[model samples]
Target chain A: MRLEPIANPGLARSAGLPAAAIALTVVVASLLALLAGADPLATLGLILKGAAGSKFALLETLNRATPLIFTGLAVAVAFRAKLWNIGAEAQLYAGALLTVLVGTQLGLPGPVALPLMALAAILAGALTLLGPVLLKTRLGVDEVVTTLLLNFIMLLFISMLLEGPLKDPLGMGWPKSEALPRDARLPRIVDGLRLHWGFGLALICALGTWVIQTRTTLGYEIRATGLNLQGARFAGIPVNAVMVKTALISGGLAALAGFSEVAGLKGNLTLDISPGFGYTGIIVAMLAMLNPLGVVVSAIFVAGIFVGADSMSRAAEVPTYIADILLATALLFMVLAIMLTRFRVVRG
Target chain B: MDLIDILLSASFWAAVIRIASPLIFATMGELICERAGVLNLGIEGIMVAGAFAGWVAVYAGLPLWWGVAVAMLVGMAFGLVHGVLTVPFGLSQHVVGLGITMLATAAAYYAYRIALPEVTTPPRIEPFQPLDMGWLTDIPVVGQALFGQTALTYLALLVALATGLVLYRTPLGLALRAAGENPSAVEAQGLSVTGIRIGAVVVGSGLMAVGGAFLTMSAFSSFFFEMVNGRGWICIALVVFGAWAPGKAVLGALLFAGFDALQIRLQQTGLGAVVPYQVFLMVPYILSILALVLMSRRAEVPAALMTPYNRGER
Candidate 1:
């Protein structure tokens, strides 16, 4: 008997695969939990309970999920167009820097300043990818290398900014920029909870992304370009333009992640603010099967896992990194399941 | 002190070579792997896993060489996972490679927690001693830098030389290159492209692991979280800068290490106060990007670089 990938699968089969993959992830993670001397069932229950068992916990989960929604949507759009924008991490930082500078310097009222901050963030994020995209289009430079390299460079630039010009005088030797004034802060959605209008903004972005991908001519061109670059070019799809547009949109979305963190959560920019939220977006996008609407679900699920893991570590004495293991394993299984959609497994 | 004083110092040169050793080992491996058609983004995690494994070995009272062996084995095992998914399943290389990195990195972190839970200061082991070649180490700037270095530094040079011989001078190397450029063509010639690619990945990852181990076993003597610190990614860039050649890759690693050493020295000498030290830290990454842009147009990348092969399919 031999196994091979099946061609031309239907939607039902595709839908079933991710469910099976999540089940597989649960099993593998259980084995890990067992090895770590914890009861798998209890650990799983604790995780779910920690993330959504109470109103406060659920609020925290959604708060944690807000940035991921933006980042995940960013990744989904880029991957859909076959543009590997690994610089989301850098782009996010770029957005944050721009947002901070604009918000702090402009000193406009809330109505005027918030919109300006968002625009600066989105534009700065998109602009960061311009050099890499242009290089890829013009000279055949690999975007993966350039984008990944930019992440390091942008991070150092952020460090330079914080320690040099941006450092707050009253900050007492901490490496952080000055906090945004009340007019610049995101209006909190729920009083006493960390949830803010950024949560609403994330949902809107996700819905907007879904509409763009499904209903727009640009979406069709992007889909065609990703499916077959040569064929798209042959069909007069303007493949390069599609790639550049996708990069811009993806980079802009990633910047929103940065914006949310600074405006809603942190209130001031620090070197340690992100904690690799941008990179986690790639996993979320993949787990969502690169679908825009699904990005919301996956982002929330991932954020829940992370938040729950921290709680589990404190309450159950489980290692915090156990969450990382489960997430990584889930990522692998999800991809394997997704790829399985391309080919049916048949035994001969 | 002026620029000449720093440039002329034996210790500065020594610092460059010492700092570059890990990159040299990793770049050779990365060059070989890429030449064989698989882009292993798992390099970062593999290096971290290697560092952890080596540290554990030394902590367990094993010799330094034993620790290196264990680290290489861990790397090869991770490579095997990458090979199985990408080679046979025909999965996307980028996703699978990234997944493997995440898995390995998580595993390394978990292992570290289990082994040394909640230590305020990280544990240290006996690091490899410098092999001072008496008369050889006395020659101005080149002497102490080249001759009075750790044995692993010397081994890194040997690995580079051996990689060159294996890649350019051997028939197996030709088959490996052929497998990357055109796997179907290699299969047509009755060589198992799968076998060649898998072997190359396993060996290449093993070498990368050794590079990681060198950081813990020789350079620092302690395994801290994120000690690899994007060195593996830098090695990936260096491979592009080197145009996939082992010899040129050596130069790339040295250039990166030179910047790193210079920055550390400048910071120590209070000269870095004029500009934020981050400016110097940014130099290596920025230079690599510039190198990528300049050389990429002419780079002869293997044709089938990121594609998974399925028999009877185009």
Candidate 2:
């Protein structure tokens, strides 16, 4: 059997498949809602209304999606370079720790402190990810395994800090860091809402990623390397260096997610902040077909589903995990839809 | 307590065996799958599914052994899902694997919550108890630790050794290995590489389910949301650390289990206060990374790993 993509699978037709997949996912999710004893149409209406029905919902949705954009971009960068950096979650934690540790200790003005926190977070994410990168590049260690395991190690490392030295002495015994001072917390973009300046940073990061991926030498090397590692090596492209740099950038991007959450929203570190954004980012990257710009749109879509589902659960008897089912179903359909676009399957 | 006091105690060795049991099964399962070139990153999710399925079955008044069967069957079904997606479609292995993990885990958690609405005070059943070793349990320091273990623990040891033998000594194993190493060669020899690879994946998934069953049926004997945690990931690492050899994989699992058991003891002994217990928990994961670095130089990856076997395509 062989697959030959029909010559120039028309742009519209190519685009049509993903749209069809979205429909398929919605139908499946509706059936699931029906099983949970809810009217599918009503459930869908509830989700839509809860997601963006009002002014407050819009801000909340964007705020929720802010971290996802960073993590999704993190996953996109590494995946596009054919580097599997599954440690993004841990790298996010590393950034969170640095945001608190550096902010409290340095005591710089807001402008200097914010940039310093961002830089420290980026460096922290990159350096923390260096272990897996070296093992992967130098020794051929499976990054999937190493990076994944490093998440566990990172979780333990951060938990140690949060519970031991960094524990807030006055937060009634909860294991979280002291709140960031006014100088350190990210400035708010709106009054009476949690929206913060990190939203702007996230937008800029997405734009920067788009420009880099589509219009630069490094981007060319990365895309080429992802397309064909052997060919890239043969073409005198530094595949190893590209992989390392992508890994660093990927880690930095993920770290910024932590920075956004802590500095922009929480103003303190806690274990409950991220709900698997690092892992979900993979789905976002795949949904966008690894396009940097598409990541922003997909990230927001995922966030909307989750946040809406939370409100839906509060309003109805349905559980919130139904969103997980919807998301996973959508991903499977997306992959199948993509494969269909790329290949004309023949009987084996 | 001192290092000797920790290592020499019967409780220490028992904890090691108890902890190593689930990993031994998972690592051996991974060894076979990787050897056959399937690279089922879905193993983690499948194990979680198995744990939930087994627990639900036993809770519903089925025989304990029946629950084990339920686990294996559920795992095989997922193995089929993974095989169809990766083997035929040639989708990204990591993407499919990660997606399966998320879906299966979420489904399991949902089922647990929905099935048992009394989440505040959950029901419990009597889990399998350790076997009686009689005189064997009476032996000085090693007696209780080595002999007084659950039946699953001993089965895990036997499975590890059996896997090593089957991998090295059997004809089917040869076909599986050949399929992974050079599928084109195997296909030319009038053999179905795809069939062998799919068979490998299904069988590996079944064993992994049993490993999951061990967690619910023997280790903790209760289903928790995050029970499997990262053990599946650890098993993946153990396979690499042991260079894809089942016997060595068992040893690697034991090493990790020993570290895990030791940390618990050190923590309880108040030494954990000196260094936060969370830091001590990092020891096993960190040590495994070091082991991977040391072992990767001699690692023997299957040539066709993560590659779909497209029939008649160069």
Candidate 3:
């Protein structure tokens, strides 16, 4: 089962399995589209151009990328401790809900209201992660199931809130919450685009996560446990604490993503607030090889594809699902590639 | 309808049966796969694919039975893909399975969008009618609940019994168990671990396909995007509750189905209950985590559950 590995870490290291697989995926996806009568090269060109060709397109890409940065860092942080926190979607929603509830309900001044709302949102997300973390570390239950199942429950809760508790009275019958006070809104950075301070917050979080992951005592213990649990235990690293802490941080970061969406863009929570940012974060983390800084870069790359998908849908008469297909293909290749990076292959 | 009247109605039982039926098929399929030491995480995808393929076939003028058969075939193909990815490719099973689920979901959506015009409403077929046992109608609640269900509902229960017999009483079951529990020892005894597991997954896929087809053809009567919902993941939890036993898994599925049925029923009653529906919606997952935590302490995992088998190693 040992796969081929390239020992050289340099950029010039000639084609490895990861490279080959990624190239294969791009080729295969293009060929598949080409078979459907669309020109492969042209479609790719359209995708690239649609995402980054214009001043507006670049802003659109960054705007789409904002939530991903937070969630990607969320996933990467927890993954470092080998605690798979898959409930980022729920956490994000819960955070958004709390943020909206606070923003709309409390009419505090600009300075105090924003920080309190952000704090409340973070706590809401962290609270959601508590259930899974407790089940995993205390009861030895699999967090994967708990986190995933919680996602549905959280979605249902979100739906219920929009439909019942928080329904806007002014709207014609659509399911959405009341808009937040103007004072609570994040100042927009772009003149004519939706890009705002949330992207900056995500960037800051990524930087913070990078520092925590590479330069802290807790980070050392977390990585130790992830690399080798038994060895970590033998070395007196508190695995349980590290796992819990990682899950909490993961949940908090995801919640902040929710907060950003509410504060920066919408000013109120709505149904379908997230377009699967939480799920996409997993792909982003893996694509980055679980590096925090890499998550920021990969998030931007993925955001470009997403932005591109919308254009492809309008112009090429192709479904926007190509983003998912490409990502899946990239994931498969990257996983194979990353594994190869770890071990060398030879004839038995 | 009055409270007692609603409780005693045939339609109420029918609704319960409809909800329970698909979970039964899927949970049993999951039981077999987990018992064989391969947790096929692609069940969600396979089920959705089956639902779409089954509905499309029926919509395109195929017989109902043939549509179900096509669903099973597609499921097997998906299972084969999963098997090759996990068994041969040696990828992380969870990651591969997750990727497959995402890919299948996206593919299913695109397929639906492409096949049908955006403005056109999707087609729906007449759902399979429940079998009415004319003589057994005299038997009150038992007759209404058991004798008046869809063919798939009965099949699900019968399959559970059949799976139990095969897994617990047959020599084939013993060999399969040995393969999962200790693949190297099974290999030493001249058994093919890969073959047994692949077979298990393929069969499991077929069972899961039936579950999906049941969702479309029997329960809802049409395929929709994200139709399988979270049922596939629920089956993963059910596998733990079942302790890798078919009978136990079926029981767990029934419990979840009952909870689900009750949730819907309660919502419809307009009882104005104080408890949030979301909390109740979380019942299955919450119960599963609680059950797993309790059972895993006392229960046993297959010796080689998550480990990839290397033919010549050890």
Candidate 4:
């Protein structure tokens, strides 16, 4: 009998691959820019200027990054616990719809109304998560399928609201909800700044997520179960409970993002309230290598791409879809590069 | 309400077939892919791609069938890319799947703007003609309901039965099932996991493209941006509702289609004018969630689904 022994030198390989992935994404994206008939160097400059060159630009970037922060954290949290919840977009809509119902229909005072709306958002989001969670836990349904399916339902619900019940009667037939009252809106963090208190909330949430992920007992159990559910079960962890708990927390965080978008940026509910922020969060979380602090940087980077892409569209006459292609291409490049961390590549 | 009278009408049946056509096509494709363990998330993108390509081909003066052929070819090409990326390149399934979606969406949007710049009414071909069975039309309810659907509707039902038989009673089906359930185990037994997956991807995406073509050739004679409108995702759910089988998925599609038809009917009725339109419009999605919640007990996910396979590794 011939035995082939496994030679596992792991730490060195893992340590080197993440940086390699980032570099690969940049290089591949530069090549793609050439194909799109734009100079990569010039495009990068425009992106920088658009994202951070001026106070206004930087403010916009941060404003855009705010919801991404919460959603990136949401995806990262559920992913860390080994659940694939692809329904964040739907959860965001659920949150937004609930916030509208609470904030607009009830007609309460500002301070009290805002908190009530936030609570409603969180509750709606968490409730939406319960179906997938319970189906996975009790009925052996795959959460991936259940959650992905729910996304359509949520979007359709939004369409229903916007096109019918929630349409602003004052807007002359626009498919949008009534705008929140002046008191219901969040104050800008500074004069002439697009930044709102949502940015602060995002920052605080990031810090809170970092601490919860690293310092708490729940984190330990969640992390252990993520590594191997059966092993965690053997180690006396209640795996199913952890999965459900983490999923609800994730959904709640994502919903909070919806609140931020509605209350912080857009006062009125619109069909396109999310410019795919929830979906973008998936790539951001994965690119961050699932680190809480890393998610902040990755979110900012993604926000820059979105912000800069518009400038490039204006300046170079390049379509914004080019930027979309670049962003998606870079994500694929990153995923491919990351695969090298676990598996060695050989030409043989 | 006169909802029952509206439901009993011939137009209501036409609406049901129209709504169900794309879903039947998509769910069938998803059924094949899931059976083989690939879980083609690219169906959303592929459907969008097909919608664009089919419309473009039609606008370019090609026959509708030719447009469909080109769409299927394009879908197959996309499947090839998806298969190679995950199976050979060993990328994350979800990541590659998402990439395909984004790529297809961007491509469709770009192409739509380029091709249909001035056409406000949208570029349309003559839609597929409804097939009226001569004798079957004599039966009041069943005839109007089942016998007067377009060719694609009947074709969708045929695809369902054919897929069902193939999936359950063929050697290829057995091999694909083995690949999905336990690739490494299958590979140990001298099967080609990559080959099986690639084959599944091609066939599945091709089916999804037909679903897309159904959108143009039967439901509407034109294509628009994001026109699949989350139906691909709905098909993904339908796969679950069908227990990853073809026959049940068609049933699920028809069930949802019935609700959609009723919703449209309600939208046209006097009662609909009195009530909020949102409640009527939300019927399909709300029904989808209800279906999910109700059928949560019957989920039987494939064991090896979504897991990237390695050649002979533990």
Per-model RMSD to reference: 1.9, 1.8, 2.6, 3.6
At residue A273, candidate 4 shows an lDDT of 90
lDDT of each: 0.87, 0.85, 0.81, 0.80
lDDT of 2 by residue, B1-314 (tens): 47789888888898999999989987887778888887878878878988888888999999888888898898888777777777767777788878877887877776776677657755666677888889999887788889999887898899888887788898888888888888888888888877887788888887887888888988876888778878888898898888787878888998899999988888877676677788787888888778888888998888888888777667
Interface DockQ of candidate 4: 0.40
DockQ score of each predicted structure, in the order shown: 0.64, 0.67, 0.55, 0.40
Best by DockQ: 2
The native-contact fractions of the candidates, in order shown, are 0.66, 0.66, 0.60, 0.55
Could you give me the TM-score of model 4 versus the true structure? 0.89
Instruction: Mark the regions of model 4 whose C-alpha exceeds 4 Å error after superposition.
Output: A1-45, A97-117, A156-169, A173-178, A181-184, A346-348, B1-3, B88-91, B117-121, B131-151
Task: Provide the lowest-lDDT 10-residue window in model 3 chain B.
Answer: B263-272
TM-score of every model versus the real structure: 0.96, 0.96, 0.93, 0.89
TM-score of candidate 2 versus the correct structure, residues matched by position: 0.96
- Give the higher-TM-score candidate: 2 or 3: 2
Question: How well is each residue in A307-342 modelled by candidate 3, as lDDT tens digits?
Answer: 987887678867778888788778877786666565
Q: Flag the better candidate by DockQ, 2 or 4.
A: 2
The digit string of per-residue lDDT tens for model 2 on A269-294 reads: 99977888888888888888888889
TM-score winner between 2 and 4, please give it. Answer: 2
Residues B52-77, model 1: lDDT tens digits: 89889989999889999999999999
lDDT top scorer: 1
lDDT of 4 at B104: 77
> Which has the higher TM-score value, candidate number 3 or candidate number 4?
3
